[model samples]
Target: MNVAHFEGAGAPPRKRPWTAPGALVVRALGNAAAAAPVEGAMLRFGRGRPGDPGKPVDVTVGVDDTKVSRQHGLLVHRSGWWHLSNTGRLPIEVGNHVLQPNGDAVPLRAGVTSALISTADRRHLVELCVNGSEGASPAPAFGLHTAPGHVWRLDERERLVLAVLGQEYLRNNPRAQPLARHQAAAQLAELRPGEDWDVRKMDRVVEAVRLRLSGQGVFGLVQSDLPQPIGNLLSHNLLTELAVTTSSLTSADLMRLEGAD
Candidate 1:
């Protein structure tokens, strides 16, 4: 018996047909859509009407989201090469790049390589060979540029997602507290209340609890202040942190700390 495999069977064969060396063309659809500057939408809901002038001109990468509006400003010199600053209420994600060109739609040619970001998980997925384009369809905002270097257009939703995720990330990160216990408790209480109001009483209550749990490592569950789900998450997170500290620190290390001592 004889078996044979085709030349491109083991791997995707390259098929570059009049394609640019390292360029990507993305359609202004999904969350990436935005209205053109003048007669354009603040958000690209979907589909555009005919005879719309001052359409979101094709923009290049490197433009900031905040500066995308007031085109006359960012477009300082290049009149033909339009620019966009992310103006949407959304966050400026370091990832997530899209390409949408005007006039003509071009599919990624066979053997061409590019990365598409998953709108759901925010992960890179799908390396394709022989991707096709239906040609430039009407898009509120689109981009034509090289692959994976800079991003220009960022929509509002995209910005929001990034902001929320970033805040969550920072919330989870641990930090060392150089401040004394009294000073640290004062700061934490301040974050929850107003300067004009009476915060000292509240601070005292927290300090009492902080003292009781100082060495035992059990911060009493104060169910009165937390929403059920948030409380659960907070408790889970705090306990996890405590477990790590318990495992990593020696009794001497805990004793050396002024307050814990």
Candidate 2:
């Protein structure tokens, strides 16, 4: 059952499928050939050894890329899948998509996905491969935490809209990029072919989402806040205190939204 987050709306939380992978292989793509198995669920990448051994990041890059940060990025292991989150000084680009510093992560799809870490100091190319993930794919789940005691859940449409915008924000200009808004409208249109959609309509939906957040006593999303919550979202950076990032997207959510399931 779909529970709208309009007024007083909620449903029980869902537990998505979580599968453990056999291993993650990271390869340095340069001069010769070198490979390593990411030890645990979390891997941290960078040039030198981590200053603090207690830090939980799991991967390290042994390359000539001096520009790479000690804590460049991370491949965090979730319940069922692995997601790439940028934690470095530079952006992490994967599959032609770029993630800003501390930007939203992308789920690891099948096959090898390489990310380019570009910096004036050093440029490095690394590829990630998920070896032998075993289990049934889980349903996609979206959620939000507005206030300390309040929570909001996104319906399929809302989830899809935010996801499209989030990814677009990462791909283009986070601040001035119009791709997110325009592309989101296109995505929403694909979801509901019976209705007509324009940029203005999509704006209305976004405004409505903000209103819902404000109505729930969340102050950061309404009117004009210094951080500009909507602007940040438009840039694909999630309101960690309020919304979930695109990395949380599930195959089931995609299928149902596209009417594929």
Model 1 lDDT, residue 211, Cα? 44
lDDT of 1 by residue, 126-194 (tens): 222222242222223347555453222224322222222122222333322123334434544444344
- Model 2: CA > 4 A from native: 1-22, 29-40, 49-62, 132-261
Judged by lDDT, which candidate is best?
2
- Against the true structure, what is every candidate's RMSD? 21.5, 16.9
- What is the alpha-carbon lDDT for the whole of candidate 1? 0.27
Candidate 2 structure, TM-score to reference: 0.40
lDDT of 2 by residue, 70-94 (tens): 7787776554456788877888877
Cα shift from native, residue 149, model 1 (Å): 24
RMSD of 2: 16.9
